[model samples]
Target: AEIGQVDGLLQDFPANNQAFRDANFDIEQLRKDIDQSE
Candidate 1:
């Protein structure tokens, strides 16, 4: 069951990544926010 779940996640990863990029997700800004809180 775990193996099947992993396989599904692997198959979905590219689509998920594309959607994440399409949303203009900003990693640098996130890091900056984290830095400010620290």
Candidate 2:
């Protein structure tokens, strides 16, 4: 069961990583827009 849980986490890692990257990109874009507005 523990091994299965680890495998499940491994399978989810890529999606989680992608989401994190997308969030960071959105944050960066928002910062840039705010800077431009200032």
Candidate 3:
């Protein structure tokens, strides 16, 4: 996705927000990035 698309998603999707509620994280794209790296 383009930066614009990601930025838009971050703006619209509450789950996509990077704000930390606790020590845990969203882990939404972690698998995707890890797969690509592998």
Candidate 4:
């Protein structure tokens, strides 16, 4: 649910946007950590 909202926000940025890329990377890492925790 929260991840979906974050993905939607990421989509709102242009493909070339650096911040969006960084955020995507961070989100990917976060997902990995969450999966590992479970």
Give the best candidate by lDDT. Answer: 2
The reply for model 2, stretches above 4 Å from the true place, is none
Between 2 and 4, whose lDDT is larger? 2
Q: After superposing candidate 4 on the true structure, give the runs of residues whose Cα lies further than 4 Å from its correct spot.
A: 1-16
Model 3: per-residue lDDT, tens digit, 1-38?
A: 99999998877777534344322343646766788999
lDDT of each: 0.88, 0.99, 0.65, 0.88
The residue-level lDDT of candidate 1 at 4 comes to: 94
Number of the top TM-score candidate: 2
The clash count for each model shown is: 0, 0, 0, 0
lDDT of 1 at 14: 100
lDDT of 2 at 12: 100
Candidate order by TM-score, decreasing, is 2, 1, 4, 3
Q: What is the lDDT of residue 2 in candidate 1?
A: 100
Question: TM per model?
Answer: 0.58, 0.93, 0.34, 0.56
| RMSD (CA, Å), each prediction | 5.8, 1.1, 11.6, 11.6
> Per-residue lDDT of 1-38 in model 1, one digit per residue for the tens?
69999999999999999989966667767878999999
Work out how many backbone clashes candidate 1 has.
0
